[model samples]
Target: MTQLSSNKASGCTGAISPVLIGAVAAALLVAALLFSASSPGRPSSAARSAKAADSEAAKRYHKDIKPILEEFCFDCHADDVKKGNLSLNEFKDDADLIAQKDRWLAVMKNVRAGVMPPPGKSRPTEAQQRQLADWVKYGAFGIDSRNPDPGRVTIHRLNRLEYRNTIAQILGVDYNTDDEFPPDGAGLGLDNIADVLTTSPLILEKYLKAAEISLDGALPSEKGREFSVQGSAFKGNNNATGDRLSFNGAPEVVFAYRNKNPGSFRVQMEIEVMAAATGTNETSTSPAASGIATNICHFVVGVQSGVAPLAVLLERDFTAEPKKHQFVFDRVWSIEPHVFKINVTAPGIRPAGRGGGGGGRGAAPPVGPQLRITNLRITAQPTAEVRRFFAKDAPPAAAKELQDYIRQGVAAFGLRAYRRPLDEPTLNRLAGEIEQRYGETGLFNDSVKPSLAKVLCSPRFLFRVTQTVPAKSGEPWSLIDEYSLASRLSYFLWSSMPDDELLNLAGKGELRKNLDGQIKRMLNHKFAARMIENFSGQWLQTRNVMKWTIVEPEVLKREGKTAGKPMLTDEIRQAMKDETTMYFARIVQEDRSLLEIIASDYTYLNEGLAGYYGIPGVQGKEMQLVKLPDDSPRGGVMTHGSVLIVTSGANRTSAVKRGVFVLD
Candidate 1:
């Protein structure tokens, strides 16, 4: 009898009752007895009968199985040939073959499925095949049944894209990790694959830098600068009368302001609009269509930055008299430059004959209203109250308040970073670290920076670590926790951390139930387009087109004859890559059948690519969807210039390479 008390165990220090111990011991004894009975030999008569049957099967392997393999499989899988990296010639006995259990299992599956000998190859007799199956089934050379092996996945670090997007979502600030960190390794045609995304000392250093940069954007340390530019400085199309700027239909004047500081800013525009010449017959119209006689100039104001998309800020009608308009933009988080645009259109026009003929006798046609911009100013100033939260020196009363703020901030950030709530211990540890750092460095940002950097470098934030749960009775694998499932779904689709909605759903334990709906929502999001660029770029090998060079001497010689006409230019290459990326994005966005990737009636094209493919109608740098003719050969990705050029050699096309790509 075995003692099963937890206290007696080497590592277990807990106490167990004698009754529980006795129950456990009885279960262990029953399991052992069952295992013994199932073995080749035992005292029971059933065990003896099974041993005799195995012995007979063993004899068949030596006499029948070995002969069949040698006659049929040895030709391709022998030691000398070793086709498909397989060698059966080395197995002198069943024990030797059984040692390589996985290989033999595959052999059994292939042979039994009638795919091993291959088409047109001589096959073994039905009796011989049965003997081989019996040999494997009866445990060749005393080996037990093979167990299924589900491969393990290694811990994956957040790639550059994931890091940037995750930080943006967490902090409400944009930080480009790709610019600061080294490029991640691409294995299995994806940078996000678990086995390939490894951590290193250099990567940790980069993470520290990235954390500091992100924190700085979130909490600025200095006052922002103010600058202004003149609207006359902007380049615009010259009208017939070039005295003033004229916007016929579209706004041509663009004021590009490079914002060096990250804080609040105000933009002011001062302009004088020329009065419109009313016709003799023109009368009062609807209130919306008509405004104050002298004040009727309508202009649309918008702002755009590299970090975010363009946003229209204001649209209103201004007086023709000189006036100043001020617009206030708050919290301006992007470090990238911004473009403030003012789109002004001429006043409503009167019909040629219905309104009144051209001015008077010989007078020229009444000139359309023109806009003259006298001043355009931008002033950036930090919010003093908000800045106090990140101030280094704290007042007596606010010190404790600041400490609480730091704790809450770190906890909130950790929840997003880890994609789950932090435990009490972890929260306390981080808060303590921030307090200690604050004591060492008086600056609030300085203290928070190091603590946040540590969190960013920590394994919990860096890697997607899935907790292992014990499998329930009769189950082969354990199910991942709700939080883990949320993270997996988000990272798989968006290449970023789960949003607050996803986290909330996971907390409520409803993520799995609503997973399909959540996936559709995520696919519809604008960020999901990253999948098209990052995934398809690698899987289709279109990204490599930029790196391809014409190395063939003959190709170079032919290119020398056409000095100005290069076979492949950077513009043409980019257009080709964009074509494939846009096509893939459309397929996902429209939920079209994936088979369209191989054969579709339409593709995206720009002027450069359209010219390259000899297709007419495309006339601009912007890419647009174009329908292909029935006889056109450029419908799918395989026919795209980027794919064709990358797969082809410098001088000529490789039929074998194209064939292999199609087959793959």
Candidate 2:
């Protein structure tokens, strides 16, 4: 498992000194004034002819630049690693740079070319450029570096989608119930990373409820059916009837009986299983045939009276009719019963019989059915005691039985990207809280309801909790209290709680000092899957894609689209999801520039999606990464089906929303 971490730089190795910022700022101001004086926005004939002379004049020192340099340069070119090493630490006036005239000219040159500080960096305007030309004429000055005031901010808990994806990845279970929890509040223009996203009592209740729902299991339906076994004894022992029976849909059992079984009886059972189909297959628009193996039922003989049932016999090695190639489980049984009602008990199987007159001497059930009940012959052996017998597996608890559920909450809703392992005490306390909520409130199914509500609601989970209370006298103090810091750093960057490795680092007192290594390790973690899910889903509005339901055929035709044509099926939705996931995955793995998300030459699409976009030759349900045509405006999240649909309003796309999404 890979660790997740923040992208922030650490240790400040070789970082630009603070003094350089001031020097650069001064250089920019002077250069801006010089450029303005030399060039006009609309050039005149005389101005163009004097360009070379103006340029030479701009390069001169002391005679034309001393005053300009004194006003701007002396404050920042002091000796200091304070802001990118402008080094004004020793000087107080313009003469300092004047003594190093060549250095001042070099600064003047870079500033005039508009390349010194770089765009988005501290740079000079046209007016400042003209001043720089004048400063070179007067000579340059050194200045001290000044630090800016720090910005104030709040930390936030992980959002709902992130929390959901994180838990699903951790537990390998796709339980997306986070939507039922209370909505997260936005901070810093994003619900995901805001420190202001705190939890409330209602959220705690939701968490507990979600936890219970995630862990709880329930018994199969209680409804039962009855059938009969029939055969003609036309041959010797073991050669009478070729009975074949099977069961399907949910795990269950079967029963068999013969009228002349006054003594001993024997029966057989066989089974075959097929792979289960997923949600996508059920909603496929294309029609193609697929076959599945018929599961044979395992019969358990039981004596039934009123609503109670007692085991009557157990089966051994028995083969179903037809061939062995189509067979799976083959077991046979021999039993002798006295004063016990014999019945076949395969809950998930349906047998074919003739009369439906019940299994009696002259009564017969249906026949030639997909399920059979032959191999019937009674013996004259003496009846055994009604004490006990055997059957298949035991019964599970019904609705009336007691149950406890445990829900693993989502990852993105907490400090996910950090490395922190919750202690046993924490888990136990959480479990206790879970138990209390269920037992006290009588709402076991909604355990996650309370689990989410409580954890997300708590200040302990939401706040970074950086305030350190000193240990009492004679008590041992922790080394740096890195656990709190670890928690803060992870939530700040990754927008989720730390995992075991991170927590372990904090425990070992390594995270705070070794932030660089920890951050690197955390970025490679599997839970980083949560990062893609949360960041991309919410930011890209991929969650809103499913709401685009199909309307009437007339409406479709009016929109210049097909009505009878299958628009978005379950398969297509899943394909779109795969596209979203793949795109997000690339962002994390490649550490790609975020700007690529606004406009890229390539996108993920399937045949259905390709058709929707009027692209040709794409066929089938599988999703593929395709290169978008240069002519198409469809690129990145703005053009993605999910994102576009999500940002759209009723009956039309809203430019305002799309614009805000792009800007945000």
Candidate 3:
């Protein structure tokens, strides 16, 4: 049996027990009996009976099934003419069909679906169709239970998107892996295809970095909490006077820092200094100090409440560097209200006698010397809310308590990260790493980051692994344990690790029973959107929308002719991608027919895409379902802007490419 022992199995609640073990001798005895009964001319009379039944089926296939195929299907599917690359000529008997199961299986699908025997052709009667399908289904050379095959899993690393999503789900950190990791190669345009997602030394390094970054983002700081706020709060600096001001994006963000608790604040500004010095100041880096260090542009960092100006750190005047570089302005200030205003001026320090710029009038933006803040990190003592978050995160001081904390924390985290419960050895090794790191520093939370990094970088977390068990009498292909099933279901549906519900079900071995409901629930989940994004993004080549230069239709590359449609911008390109993914998402979420993807009377559209497609009445930026008119050309994904543009050349459509996309 492949089942883990009850004592050895590990998960949140219970372990994955795929099959129970039996005595080897008893299993072999049963196998021998079963084998003898299935084989012809054995000592058992059951063997003769089985052989006779097989002969009877073959006789029926030749006498009944062969004529049926010849009369209806042979015109296009026999001898040299192989329609759909399938020929009845090759499968003269059940033996041929059994040897090449996939060929017959494909035919069976079409035949059962009433898809074969093309339109306006002589089709088989209901009885004949049933006979053909049933014979293929049951009467033919059927499954040899003794020699079952469930196929081998390629066991590849998650692609960049999956890695990102997995990190988000497991660590609560929305880590972006695309920027750091190399683009995963695609197999048949599908990025998640196992064999194509090969790991390399560079990828390992990327994983290592990703682990640390993910942990940093997920974990709270010791005593204080730190987080990255957007520099966009003051991105558009028209006045060029304020030291700090508030505004809004990883995307667009408008953060309001309000601290009710009493504590000093450490605000680290990743600022880039642009020095425009005049030759007046005595302070110089070299002999001449660039001859302009006399009238140096020093930054005034201040805070304000209404018009009453308050200097939080007036003694510190930041001077310009020799070259433009990101300066880390990390300092703790005894400031109140968690609010502040910063004064940024050009050449303000005129030998220590100069005043602020413009004298009440707005300072000109084209002024010399500029300081741009790219990242703003605020660190403050943990509030009650934050303290509650890391109540258990902060380790105890006592030796025994610390060890228990480490064990429990590491096991729980590893289970989540690895997407399955850790075995005893693995659990101990992981907890020991954290304990060792903590022993050196005596800071439990600090040590957890490296432990998390180690877990994230581990091969078990990186790859989709499955344990194997020996086949049983009638259960030769029961290889996917409950935990593995949970992982597979989660990755396919959510593009991440299994959530608690799934894990709970898996732990209790009830996941298989609730699979249909779980599938339905998951398809409607927000995470399922990732499936639409990643799968359709690659397959339809919509992810390449940004790279493709979409010009106005019918407008030539020549500079003079540019009057066909509105200017195609990046927004429109993004909308094009959104269209296909949303369409695919609707198919699964709404439980609509998959055929709708080919030719339907509905699609998703926002005002932008609607305007682009000449469809009226869609009035918002939010993409929503829009039913199409009978004659609307924008019925299905095949006609989507993303697919069409991707399959077309610039200002031209490739019939061959379009055909290949449709056929393939």
Q: Over the stretch 1-664, how does candidate 2's per-residue lDDT look in tens digits?
A: 1111111112111233244334334443453354335331222433353344344443454454444444445445543433445543343443343565666676678678876555655555578778775555442432212311112333334466555544333322233444466778765546765544665556544544433332221101111111123432212122422232222221123333422211122223222222322111111111211122122324443433223345454442223343322212211111122222222323222333312322333222111112333433332211121001101122113422222223132222222322333445655565566456556655442332333333333344423444333544533321226776776555544655566666667778777778988777766665556666666666666655666554446556678977785666666666666677778778668889877777888878878878877877777777777887779888776677776665666456679978887787
Residue 65 in model 3: lDDT: 85
Model 3, 468-526: lDDT tens digits are 44445544354567788888999998888888888889888899899899998998788
Kindly list the per-residue Cα lDDT of model 1 for residues 14-63, writing each as its tens digit. Answer: 22234433433454345345433433223254346446655666566667
Show how many residue pairs clash in every candidate, following the order shown: 0, 135, 14
The per-model lDDT (C-alpha) reads: 0.64, 0.44, 0.61
Give the TM-score ranking, best first.
3, 1, 2
- Candidate 1 residue runs with Cα over 4 Å from true position: 1-118, 121-153, 225-257, 262-316, 320-325, 329-406, 432-450, 470-479, 510-527, 546-572, 582-608, 616-630, 648-664
lDDT of 3 at 501: 89
Error of 2 at 647 (Å): 3.3
Q: Which candidate is the best by lDDT?
A: 1
Please tell me which predicted candidate would have the highest TM-score against the true structure: 3
